[model samples]
Target: MDPFEDTLRRLREAFGVGRTRPAEFRAAQLQGLGRFLRDNRQRLQDALAEDLGKSAIESDVSEIIMCQNEVDLALKNLHTWIKDEPTATNLFTKLGSAFIRKEPFGLVLIIAPWNYPLNLTLVPLVGAIAAGNCVVLKPSEISKGTEKVLAELLPQYLDQSCFAVVLGGPQETGRLLEHKFDYILFTGSPRVGKIVMAAAAKHLTPVTLELGGKNPCYVDDNCDPQTVANRVAWYRYFNAGQTCVAPDYVLCSREMQERLLPALQSAITRFYGDDPQNSPSLGRIINQKHFKRLQGLLGCGRVAIGGQSDESARYIAPTVLVDVQETEPVMQEEIFGPILPLLTVSSLDEAIAFINRREKPLALYAFSNNNQVVNQLLDRTSSGSFGGNEGFIYLTLPTLPLGGVGNSGMGRYHGKFSFDTFSHHRACLLSPAGMERLNEIRYPPYSDWSQQLIRWAMSSQSCTLL
Candidate 1:
């Protein structure tokens, strides 16, 4: 017997019966989600610590608080979001009601990654529930502690008929993908994103892929090295540099690089302390696999500061590498760890050209006192998100969207964008039964006068004053 078969069927059956369609039910679910975070704050923090060595503050700020905020936002605006969006109609349809109905896309599958397990999982789950879809959440198996907590405890807070948590790694995920879902939302690497896309294609299901890439951060000579270093180092090594949107590499002139090196080193020491491995704020790598991978990257460039690794603890000290070539292994892939590489580019145009030559990143950063440089980077380049003299603090704002372009991924989610992604905007129009007279012109009337009238009614000119 297939393990997921019964659960998927049950959720689909529940969705078909409209158990989650009511605004009250959605609000209840959102409230329940809120309670789960509030009630299990410590439990979740412990789980995150065990899995990723996340500090309690880091877990709350990045994962728990964000999820809570999303749930609150969705609950507060559930009625407004679900209300029929009224649209303008042409002259011929002026007497009819035309609007878009935000209907749920039945069964949804949310595949989350391990880096920030709770945030990625529950954030999208909040959207799915708000949009009134039955959801099956597959939290990352790699984050076993969080996974266990989610599987064992999260279901207690949600309606089992409408929501479920599944357990598995790649094989089970592959099997799960074989089944059909109305929509799929995946957050992971571009490599796995392609697999998810391909699986979603088999059933002709729409998907929102939140994948990561080599997000670049460019520093200009006009900026203060210490300030820039403080901002970059904090975000780059926040989750032990396991952030998808973290500045993967740095691009600046050799002169600026020289200034940045010591500043970055000082910032790291300040943030993680001289003995970072002993700091409570610092996190360890997820597992041996990732630890080994990150440890190998240390050989790419000369370690300017802090290139220490402990296999037993899965700890990699907050490290910065200099003189890294563009073709180096550290630069070739998304360095999703506590390692930052610096590469020299002589001019702003060269830096722009260098970034343009690569796959569009999930997020891009530029540090400069000159607003024109920031604007130029913004206007000339394409990325999912851009940070000017900042890091990914924009994520905390629900008004802004988080997504990717090109090889990074597809689709945006955060706040209302999340609600929209899980919904299908069904176009609906209701005409009065008594409006038979207006219908004749739109029907099989071949007369010239009727044709002319129909054409005029269909055009924008007849709708209102120009």
Candidate 2:
């Protein structure tokens, strides 16, 4: 027996009755979402703190504010986003009105990951609502505190007939995927990404996967070491370095690595303090299983700085590894923790070649005092997002999108792009039904003159119907 069939059917029924299609309805849903964020700010922050040791400020900036912005943008532009767009006409259809209609895909399923649970779930929910589609949100079960709040509270704010929050782990998700959905958006690892894609393929469902990868940062010999160190350390260790877009590893020469070591040490101390485990800015691993996995990774290379681990607290200090081999475990996988490995490459060409050889990352960074070096790295490499002499600060811009290419992930969403992703642009034309004389001339009776006249009328810009 299918447990979700009834719920799915109800949402489908609501969508079929045009419950989500109106501009006012979409605006109201978005406004309600914004209010939810506004009214429950501290509760959300506390949930994040419980799950990942995330500070209230980090929770606000990275997750809460970003989601709120998407809601605001969608509500402000709902009517404009829903309007039919006019298209150029052919000569044969001079009197006809041709336009593209942006219509909803009925019901959509969004499966969010644990790293940024609230932001990932709500951002895509914002798009599905704005595009006039009923949504089924599956929050990560691993982030139990956040998941409980969303499952209980978010539904109260949203129209329950069109919105539902289902809770589950891998087993329940597998069952959920067995049902047919108009669209599916997943955020997680590539291994799970393949499973989601495979499941989506069975139903011929369209999916937007936001998966993780080993995001690379290339440091040039011409750059300032302390500047590079601070940027890399903060981004790498932010949210205990669980961010999908954070710089995962460093590629520089042995000389630059030497300069970066103490600079990184200085930065880590400045940000998290001498005892990083007690530092409120630092976060612990998500769970004991993940802590064990990260603990095993510490033996990969010579630990340059901060290699302390406390299994009881799930704490692994902000660490930097040096003289690391590409074939080591730390280098083999996307390190989703507060560990940054510095691997030495001979030159910029070598660094670029290194990045190209692997799967394209979700985000890539290159730090240099010279513009030519930055350009060369940018020109040679491909990633979902790029940062020059900075970190993932570009995520602040709603105009820019966030996604991955190749093995990293697929599809994009943020601001207007989110609205467009959930909508289907359908080509339509309205032509006259009463022009019998004009219609009859082009039908049945074929002659040399008729053929020439019809061809000219259809193809020529200078000619039209009588």
Query: What lDDT would each prediction earn against the true structure?
Result: 0.94, 0.92
Tens digit of lDDT per residue, candidate 1, span 1-466?
7889999989999999999999999999999999999999999999999999999999999999999999999988999999999999988778889999999999999999999999999999999999999999999999999999999989999999989999988999999999999999999999999999999999999999999999989999999999999999999999999999999999999999999989998998888788999999999999999999999999998999889999999999998899888888999999999999999999999999999999999999999999999999998899999999999999999999999999998999999999999999999998898958768777774799988988888888888752
lDDT for model 2: 0.92
Least well predicted 10-residue stretch by lDDT in candidate 2: 457-466
- The lDDT, on a scale of 0 to 1, for candidate 1 is 0.94
Off-target runs (Cα >4 Å) in candidate 1 are: none
How far out, in Å, is residue 398 in model 2? Answer: 1.0
TM-score, per-candidate, Cα-based? 0.99, 0.96
Clashes of each: 0, 0
Number of colliding residue pairs in model 2? 0
